[model samples]
Target: MRKRIALLAACGLLAIGTAAVPANAAEPVFPLVGPSALELPLPVDGSGAREQRLSITLDHPATGAPFAGLFTVDLRKVAGVATVRDHASDSSHQCTEKDGELLCAYKGLPVSLELDVAAAKGAAKGATGEITVTGKVPGATVTPLTTKVSVGGPDLVMREMKLKKDLRPGESQPMPLVFANEGTQAAKGVVLELGTTRGMELVETYDNCRTRTAGDLTTVLCSVEGDFVPGAAYELAGDSPLHIKATAHAYDDVLRYGIYPAGDEPKAAASSGKARAGRKLGVSPAKSAPAAPGLRASDLNPGDNRREFAFHTENTADFTTSPVSLKGKAGDTLSTAFVFENKGPAWIHAANPADSLARTVVVVPEGAKVTGKPQECLAVDADGTKRAEQLGAPRYECALGNRVSENEKVVYPFDLLIEKVVEDAKGSVTVGDWGTSAPRPHAFDPNAGDNTAAVVINAKGGTGTGPSPSPSTSGSPSPTPSASVSASASASPTAKASTAGTGTTAQGGNLASTGSTVGPIAVGAAALVAAGGALYVAVRRRGVRG
Candidate 1:
């Protein structure tokens, strides 16, 4: 029988997001998705087999709407040399295995249903098997998804490094990208990718690598294809050691890198900026006993293939905004924008591209109905809940992207129809944290008093606020009960900024990286944030925190 399930494209293997399918609003199709394959580690010294997982998750269609309700997943198997086990002890899971078939009756969507996989005793290296999973949802079509398993394969692990210590503005530091093939077979080639956070840039321009802009980030992708022998380690020998420079605007940031078998890089639009400097990044066996070897040929264990090192340059940024006071009478339509500027010894940014940047909130004075606003701004009620009607809301919030360069000014324009201008009608403009009513202390901001600005109309007895081109030191003019904000550049109807950054790895610090312990960046208390695999938070001395 033909398997009627949808298999995620064999590349990248999720290794993860809800892949969005394009479908009609009335007839959305759900695509079943999971890793393309699994690798079980059969330790060479007879340490028994290392376990991997047969995890399955779902991807929605274009609308971003997720399906709800119960769905049944049946794992009809094709026997092989690998063993599959269920986690009965996990209180929330409702799955059972019988007659060599696994069935899970899951509620809503299968966020992730994982089954343990390992090489069976006496299984030879390279032994393989398959599992076909089909979903049953009434009136819904989910093409079946299948994942293969091998007893052993190439395992690529990255090595962490100590970045240059006491990094200062405009100073550069060398980061050696190192990894090893720790599997039974050779890896044919590997793809190395680097993402240096905001305020930093990759210094080398090589023919084998291309640089692409991601919002405020610079990502470099290098292809170094060659035979990697098992048990041998390898490092990319660029024309020079790879170095990342902290620019004059740098403060806290991270260097994110990953190693993937050459063929497995996720498909992206052929982005330009593939600068060729006539240099090929060559690979060589590590001078250590290990030789540089081989990728997914499927990594028996794909979890240890990426690393992120967070560092801070001694710097601070002062972001200030001011109240704009206006004198308008009844029925007079007024035009204005709430704005702020970065006065910097440093620039401010989210750690990664997909992370949220600072925001700007604008509330109109009493008796004024908002008639014109930015498309990026969201209309919300007093409590910050999104309003069904976008215009004429009491408050509006906008996204500022993940980065704000030095001296950059972000403004959000608004046109207010004064219904009946009242004396000293006051509004508010506050900037901080991704669109929130309350913000966590910006540990790097030195001037707290200028964070909030005021907007007022029809002055009387010194009441109309937010006017004046100067930063307010008269304390907070919390005119609006609902707090939400963000901004970018001056544009029609509103302001615009860079697109928000992207994310990698949905969960866990264990996914895909070479096993390199981090250097000076790890000296502080480490906080693991799994929204993006292995994205970590660390607080440092000298008051800089990441």
Candidate 2:
């Protein structure tokens, strides 16, 4: 019976001992997970210094054991001076075990440590400090991780610009620049300045730009429109290439909040706006085209309201060469051909007198002397009324055939006959004016009267036996021909054949009398008429529109 009783007691004692093992262990236990250590980073002497405080508390430091005594705290500086009071301290507290956990009987507030660093008035270099805690709970181990306090001033480093070269005139190109805060200090009041070249114009915000001129450099104030965080790069784009420089600044307190920490790498220069100056602006060049030629009419018949004789001009060395010359004994026939081109966007109608575009250039050929009444065509007034008349029986009436488009050419033939001339001691044949006469009614149209040529030949004659000059009026008998003339005394002119427009021939080829209006109805009617005419021609030719 005694032996069994002893065995039961031993079993009970073993269980109780196992339970109390952790409660009675001697170990220093922190009331919080982190220590109450104070750390002061490098301090300046005069100016205000930034302050940072870290509060660490552990809810349950004595998990299962009593906190004994002898806890140690350590302060260290990674780059700057780290000062502290009572970095290592210890306190003894009587603890008790309840349930399975060891609890402190008296829990006093943590020991207080005051820390202050000196600050200087002027700029100072950067630095950092660290604080760590090493302590123990009864029968257990505890080591708190280190906390850091960084210190420094504003760090200025330029970054890339987002502008490209080849900017065109009157066009705005966006420019972007990035900057970084690499120091322990947080940058504020950063200013970026841009300078203008000769042709550059700044975009105004309020009708004008706020500018400050500093000797050779002009600084324009531009706002930093966006925010940038510490250790983070900020980018901004502006109007275009006008040289710019960027710097960083801030209000006093920075390091305490751990801004732009040390060990931050400097951004590469390639990321800076300074590199963009090497890029150039771009533009496209201009090109030119060739020139056109010059030409004019050689001669025209005013009487028949006919087409003028045109002559293409060649390169002239001098202005003296005679374009036309005429010499005729009392009676003779003069024939000449006028070469012409259509030079037109619209087709010419030879049959339509109202549509005819003819100007007369009468030429008296060189060496040809003419004698007798020279005929003339009376020009109608602006009212389309005539005022003068022609002499004895009209001789030649002519109008050139229809002209083609500018791509085509046409030619007209002319003939004139000489009627009479009075013999003079000088042997000169005088061409008399036979068309213009007072007290006589004028002809209504250009073809009604004789239209004389502009040039008249009066000198003796040329060596070769060429065609003789024609008389202006060929109705009467001509003078007797002398041996010197060697040509017939009577003259005759014939007209040439032509093919142009054969429409309802309503007095055509007359610009002044056309009297046409450009009204919508007229245009529509003309279009319909043209369409019908085209359809009729197509049908007559047995052709289809497609």
Candidate 3:
């Protein structure tokens, strides 16, 4: 097939693709994902830390083509900016650099190439150079990617915040989202993004920002157009400082904040909040400046762009499933549903929108065959093995995405065809984490006994199972999050650790988002979402639930 490659630049990044090809012999176009611009730290720290990694990923991570990593990379450096170091390894295969290029030979299919890039010594701030990578795939030719390697760019760093201890529910406080451009050049524009746990809500919405929310977490992305000069510190203007409020049903929660160069922030997933009609979030010069007298290039690294803090509120949420009655004759097809509700003194959110708040595990009654199941449900045996067929398994695990508002209810309907009716054949409707099949207690719930409810099919003698519904649905104490949060494709973002002098916690991390020292949900819950887990599910969840 005749192939072509195109390198288009946008938003300080490269969108690598190809032009039109004849329909008959043409394969679908794939993009080469990598940085269009790589920044090296300015040598203001007195020691030379010139090594950085350039990761070049092909199309996407899912494509497991055999020859994906066996290609070659033609490296052409600007000579004075940086140099490519030898990175041959023995695990997959030997990779070698010869004649200003790399033969990336590998026995296994690796999605990306992590090459060592060492900046030239005495590299001053604002020094511009280039490392152009030309990849040669087995079948189709890949475009040569030119990454602008500069000595310094704007490094927007957030300030470490001292969270208030002993925060009570329903209390609102102003949080100053402060950051500064600590590099050689001015940032053309700035984007500030924040993520909050289920128990907390961003009190104000701005016109320049778009908020995407799921279970207990809400993410806000704001775009502010104006140059942020180096050496000058900034804070969200006093009148427009970000305000956070703990819901009446608040429990352990978190707040994450980061600032990126104009359009360099991570992209958000679909189904987010629309920009509101409020005033745009603006920044003002900070009252207190950095301890240093003048600006040097200490904060040019991208690793320290974001941070998070876990908070605690004394609260509880009672999660329970409703007793559902299902019936059908031997040859009858029946559709029935059971309801799941959060009886809150606190609401539950998958603070990371990508994480699952909980799961609705259904063990179908004997003598019944599942014809149609809820979307994003898995067909597995009692021990959670993948069934050969997508249906008719003894067990089905349906995901409930990360957001479950207090007093909110979700109904999962299943269509089953009865092969035979067993009088009072009982199945279970329980909640389980990603790791185990046995139902267990939620981290924030005080009442642990009632999470699982009985699904009585064709009860001849009238079965009395499951905890009865709470007396009333009105006025239940709750945390933040929506009334009805359906499952959606959710994802857990990876969090970066904090270095000295900057603020921002990690993303989509285990043992990290729960809390610093104490919080309601443990690291296991985050692991279930990030590592393990919809009609309403993201790729992260699809892998886990399926």
Candidate 4:
């Protein structure tokens, strides 16, 4: 019957193969037994006792008949076993002490022999040991096994420092520093060194700190008097707050020194017997012996060992706009150019292409209709209306493209049709109008007077230029206007005036001013004179007939 049950169990095991099935399917079991490897902790201070839970599992391959066996743990190499207790309900196991070793034996099938082990006093840290197991089964082959156990020691790690606030020049601020012992053992005789670059100075003093200044840099070496316990922090700010200030822009560096458990020394030294009295051994003695047991200081790990932080002073930017003036007849088209410049200790950078740090706004003069503007300019009224229908006065907000560096200037040209005669048609052009607002806010412009410039438009053929010429009523020729009557006579016309100038300025720092020149005015004035003479002759004949 037992053999029959074993055959049925084997068939069931075949039904459920090694493939992972749904949770509903029963898991397959195997006849595997072993003593697991151990990782035992040994303190660097060697004070606290450590414990490791030991167990051996015997899984039954076929589940029908219980197979009896003798399972034993032969602990000969390991020395620190204070107590062992069986966890199984079936009381068939016993532990015996034999020749400074613990031997445990159990008799069961599909059993787990669980035991609790406590390290004995003075167990060496970083030492290696092993445990062997033997299993004897009635109808199975029991293989002997050996497993290694390593003793664990302390691991030391330093925590990084973070900036709590922005560091500024001439102002002393506390920089928080912290280090931690993340290992199992305490770190002894901890030391920390904080160094500063050219412009930074240290103000506070702490215990065991020796300050030394070499050239423009300074170093403060601090020794922590107490032992840093495991999982505890040594804060530099606890005893005395560390205050550091930069005379200008500078960086600070920090390094830590502490003792941690280095792994065990070599177990054996290589050697050959020395030469004998008469015969030559032809071998040298051992070169050196193993090192003594202790902790080791921290070594530099490229990515983890060092840290740096920096601070800076304030920066200023000054933007200025030059004056713009033009002269044009009542019906003539006028193009006036304005230049905006930056005199800065710092470059105004646009965070992105669309974000501008500075903007120029040109206020359109009255009596002058805006006919043309650069593509970068968006024509809008003061009430945010595009191409304002009411047309009292319109303004064009132009973008001065990214990074207006020191001594850099941006030129804006405007095309206007002079509708009616008005003397000194004044308007305003300004840079950095909005302070820290949309488009851009020039937060650091110290001088507001230079940011704005007046646009003076002198209307030609007005009362100030000369007396008004008599209107031709009858066949009387009109007086010829002066050769200097054109606005171009005052300013030379350039190619830029004929064609709309580009949004960006030229390569050189100089800004090319667009001349106020009208091309069609000379031709239009000649036609006007001839038409007036013909109208005067016809009106004289009608008067004579009446």
Give the TM-score of each candidate: 0.55, 0.20, 0.55, 0.33
Candidate 2's C-alpha runs over 4 A off are: 1-45, 59-70, 76-80, 85-129, 148-150, 153-235, 239-546
Model 4's alpha-carbon lDDT is 0.46
Reference-based lDDT, residue 418, model 2: 41
**Runs of candidate 4 exceeding 4 Å displacement:** 1-312, 350-354, 386-393, 433-441, 459-491, 495-546
State how far residue 74 of model 4 sits from its true place (Å).
42
| Per-prediction tally of clashes | 45, 52, 29, 3
lDDT of 1 by residue, 132-162 (tens): 6666554455656667777777778888877
The runs of at least 3 residues in candidate 3 whose Cα sits more than 4 Å from the true structure, single-residue gaps closed, are: 1-12, 15-37, 43-50, 53-77, 86-115, 131-147, 269-273, 287-299, 320-340, 349-404, 408-546
Report the Cα lDDT for residue 326, model 2.
37
Q: Give the whole-model CA lDDT for all candidates, comma-separated.
A: 0.59, 0.27, 0.58, 0.46
TM-score of 3: 0.55
What are the per-residue Cα lDDT tens digits for candidate 4 across 416-445?
A: 666875787877777874443222335667
